[model samples]
Target chain A: MEIQYILEIIGTVVFAMSGALAASERDQEQDWFGAAFIGFVTAIGGGSLRDIMLGSYPLVWIQDVTLLYIIIGAVVLSGVFYKWLLKLRRTFLLFDTMGISIFTIVGMEKALSLGASPEIAAIMGMFSAVMGGVIRDILTNEVPVLFRQEVYASACLVGAAFYLGLDYLEVERNTNFISSVLLIACIRLIAVKYNLSLPKFNRQQRQP
Target chain B: MEIQYILEIIGTVVFAMSGALAASERDQEQDWFGAAFIGFVTAIGGGSLRDIMLGSYPLVWIQDVTLLYIIIGAVVLSGVFYKWLLKLRRTFLLFDTMGISIFTIVGMEKALSLGASPEIAAIMGMFSAVMGGVIRDILTNEVPVLFRQEVYASACLVGAAFYLGLDYLEVERNTNFISSVLLIACIRLIAVKYNLSLPKFNRQQRQP
Candidate 1:
């Protein structure tokens, strides 16, 4: 199997787990349907949007029925292991980072294939990486983490920039792809570990 | 010129005003950028999603560009006449209902043209009718109106069904289209005027 295909599967599984975890962590009383729906949305929403915007028909999930099965399996596992998984916050973070990194690369490649300029490709990549989490947040009635002080979308942007920069330099396709993914995952993980975030746009207080 | 084209333009302008009204209603001091962005999102979000899902490339906004100017103009007008517009709540309601109704027919027709089944067409119609408000609500940090107590999405569904049934019965295309739009808009207007809504899934009764 192609490396891209392998990474895509891994990304889907990890993303699905993160989505289910978000639900379970918030309220353990959440039912199976809610958990499954959120997980499914997190796993596929981003890529589906990119495909739709790029005019790729039938959607990835429709074309590859395996993603549905995988999401269901992950949701079930997350539910069964919620007790033990509750202690694995670091594991979830690692997987979330991995998932977004893969998503960024895949989205950039898809956009380029669709004849988008490098700038537009980067944007599509970031959208493809972050939109799923945004949707999950909205469905669960929370302000999207994307809008909050997180190094999330920025990480995807940097990865996309790296990919485009490398491609412009005539670098090997596989090398550029792997490097970009690693850069994004590492940046996201490090930012979280160090409590780094973008500056907020809060209005200044006036002196009394 | 096709009636559909005229209705689409009217829908865009009315929806844009609603979005601007949402912004201006919240923070009186909100700048132009926020109003413009929200209006743009409201004006095109649903159709863009339906188009993307149906593999319509370049998106409607990109295809026409007129939608952007119209939305921006509406937002500015809403801002300038904020006080006057505020008292025209009924007017806003009428236009919003009309906008979503037209959107329902347009989305259903687009899906059918893309070779989707009637069931899927109905679904797309509802999606296109409500997804804009859903997006606006999420961006503004509120739970979606569709998910709350309103007969909104149900109205769209019934109208889509009506359109499909009429077409199946060999009704004229224009008749089927006009009837669907009027039915959805009327259902929505009546529901709001009569204070009708879906039963809430509230876990507990409100304390007196």
Candidate 2:
């Protein structure tokens, strides 16, 4: 399998797991449905938004049925293995970090290929990497994690910058993609492990 | 004030009232916040979605602060006048129909101005006119009214077609816009009065 395809599958599984975890936490009768919905949104929402924004024809998932089946399968499996997932939260986080890293790079590449400027491409990458989680949070009535002071979007931005740098250096495409993904995954994993986050806005009055 | 702008304001108010009503039915402690969230979604979600899809800068309400104030005010007023709103449901429906009419034409015009093809422009118009209500429904945990074999999206599509037909005939802009709005409002009101609806899809059959 192509490396990008492999990365996408990993991302899909991680996203589905996060959704299942969230649904289980809700502790409601609609747990299964909610988990499935969240999982579907987490797996496809970002790409769907990107396609709409870019005016891409026949949206990505619409063109590929495998994505739909994968989302469904992952959600069901995760729900059934809920206890196992609870014990492996750290493992899930690692996968999630890796997923977001690969997704950010893929988003940037797609946007650039569609002729967006670098700034817009970077923004698109961040949106694609985080929008699913944002939508999932909103649906679950939680303030989206993105709204909190976090390194989430910043991580995507830094990764995008690194990718752009490699491009400017005329790096080979496959090597550049791999390097960018690894850099983002490493940064994200370390940040999570250390509980590193962006500084919150200072709301106190300041003297000149 | 432009008639379109006037209708848009009316639409926002009517949609806000409907949202508040739905939220109130939930019997929750955060009913006020729920109402406000729904009201805001009903009032502005479609336009926000449209702007995002079109890559427009400074999303409509984000540019116009007054829209936020209006929705907030509406939510508060609705909460205070819940009994009165029950009595005015029919009047609210009329306002909503008018709002949808104006929005359908406005959305089509915006799409055309943005250089979208006619078919895409028509679809955008329909989407912009009905998507707010769809989002409101989803958030409230109700199935969207649009997909229920309703004449909702059809009304917008008809109005868009009317506008395009008049434009093709070289009619005056204001005349075309007004005629299209009136046509849509009349059709929608008639549909509501008679409980008219499109044919529902059978699970065993494909949509024609």
Candidate 3:
């Protein structure tokens, strides 16, 4: 398989795992509906938002039935194998990070192909990479991960910069994609491992 | 004040009351954030969705600061007067019906002004009338009122038809608007009173 196809599959699996993990943490039964909703959001929420913003017709998911089947299958399998997966949080995190890395690069590439400026493409990429988790958090009535003091969007921004830099240097497509994905994944994994986060917004106290 | 402006204010007030009622029912504290979110959705969700679908830029809320202030004020006031309002559910329902009626008419008029076909305009009107409640429900993690087996969208459909009928008869603009709003409100109130609903969708069970 082409490296792009391989990356897509890896991203899909990671996002699916993240969705399943989130649903499991909600203390709700692993029902088909809940699992499917979570999985779908994790898989396509960002892409859908990007499509809407870009005025892309038919939407990415609507154009591809394979994605629908993948989402359904992933949610069902995750629900069925919930016990075993929960024991492998580290594995899940690795998958999730890989998914985020690939999605960010792919999103940026798509935006650039659509004639968007580099800055717009970078923002779209980050939005597409993180919007799924944000939507998931909102749906679950939790503050969105994007609003948290984490290296989420920042990682995507850095990865997009790397991708652009490699493109400017006339690197091969496969090499550029791989390097950018690896760079993002490494940054995300390291940040999570060390509990690193961006500074919180300071709230000014009011006198009573 | 102009009749249209008066109707808009009435709609805003009633929508805010509906939001406050829902929040109170959930036993959520009447905090500023929760109340503002609810009120904002109730007042502008439909219009915002309509604008997005129509490709209107800047969004309605982002353009109108007064609407935001009104929602904030309404939420705070409702919270402070919770007990008194709870005892007036019937009155609130009446106002809510009126709000939906006016909103439906306004949405239809806007869609028609934008030169959409009658079918699309009618659909937009229905969506614009109910979308706020749907967003509010989703945010609160409740099944949307639209998903309920009810004549909710039907009311808007009928109102749109009424407006078109008035237009065909060459009625005055003011008369057409008022009649259409009243038609929707009356139909909705009667439907609610009689526990009326449309037939449930039951296309097919999953196929293996």
Candidate 4:
């Protein structure tokens, strides 16, 4: 199996868990259907948008029922360990960071393979890393974390650029892949630990 | 020109206006870029989702850059008349209603032409009519109007079903088209005027 394919599978599982955890955290109790729906969407939202934007057909979940099953299993596990999982905030962060890093590389590669310009592929990578969380935040009626303070999508974009640069330099594929993922994860983790954030737009404050 | 084609252009314009209006209504005064971005997304979001799901290639906006220009034009107009537009809530509602009705039929027809099943086509129609607004609301950090009190997407779904049934019975194409659009519009207007809504899922209320 291709290394990218393995990363994608890992990303899918972590995304599913992240989504389920988010659903469970909402004030309103989600029934099985609601939890499962959110989980499925959160796992697939970014990649589906990337595919759709790229005009790639047969959505990943639609083409592979196994992914659907995996999402369901993740949701079930979340429900079973709801309390324990909620207490594991650090664990949730770890999985989410891992998910984004893996998805960024996978999405960038997919876009490149489909002949998208490097710039466009880098954007696709960022979209894949963060759009799922954005959609999840939207569904839960929260301002998307993407728009909030802290290095999030920026981390993905920087990692994607690094990966592209390394590839351009003809680095070994495995070394490039592993380093790119680690770069994103480390950037995100360090940013969060240090409370670092990108500057907000300095729009003049006007009374509503 | 086909009547549906005409209606679609009209829908596009109105949807763009609706999106710009929504962005303007947010508490923060949006800069031109912010307003234009929201307008563009609200104009194309539903149709794009439907096309993507159906594996339709070359997204409408991408295939015809004219739509992008139109959305930008609408955004500029909205900015010019922001205060005046805000005061004309009924005008906004009228345009929004018209936009959804037209988009519903256009999306359903597009899906059917692409060989989607009637059930799936109906869903695509609802997505077309309401997903833009849903996305707009999400971006603005509100629970979507579709989930709030009032028949929104439901009205679109009913009209889509009515159109399909009429087609099944060999009704004249123009007649079916006009009637379906009118049906959705009337249902939506009446439901909003009378403050009607679908029943909420009566999940047991649990203390958070």
Which candidate number would show the highest DockQ if scored against the true structure?
4
User: Model 3, stretches more than 4 Å misplaced?
Assistant: A26-30, A147-149, A198-208, B1-20, B26-134, B137-208
User: How does model 2 fare in lDDT?
Assistant: 0.77
Model 1: residues with Cα > 4 Å off, grouped in runs: A202-208, B1-44, B50-55, B61-134, B143-208
Tens digit per residue, CA lDDT, model 1, A106-128: 98898888777776678679878
Ordered from best to worst lDDT, the candidate numbers read: 4, 1, 2, 3
lDDT per model vs. reference? 0.82, 0.77, 0.76, 0.83
lDDT (tens digit, per residue) of candidate 2 on B1-208:
4776777777777777777777554554455787888888888877777666666668878998988898898889988988787678788778778778877888788878876666557756876788788788778776555544366778888889989988999999989988999999899899889987653211122235
What DockQ, between 0 and 1, does each candidate earn? 0.12, 0.05, 0.06, 0.15
Determine which window of 10 residues in candidate 3 chain A has minimal summed lDDT.
Answer: A26-35
Q: Model 1 over residues B1-208: C-alpha lDDT tens digits?
A: 3778989989998888887777455543344545555677788889888887776678877556566677878887887787788789878888889988999999999899989999999999988888988888887787787877379999999999999999999999998899999999899989988988777668687699
* Candidate 2, position B179, lDDT: 94
Q: Rank the candidates by TM-score, best first.
A: 1, 4, 3, 2
Better of 1 and 3 by DockQ: 1
Output the lDDT of residue A65, model 3: 56
State iRMS for model 4: 5.1
Q: What residue pairs are clashing in model 4?
A: none
Q: What is candidate 4's lDDT per residue for B96-187, written digit by digit as tens?
A: 89899989988999999999999999999999989998888887787787877468888999999999999999999889989999999999
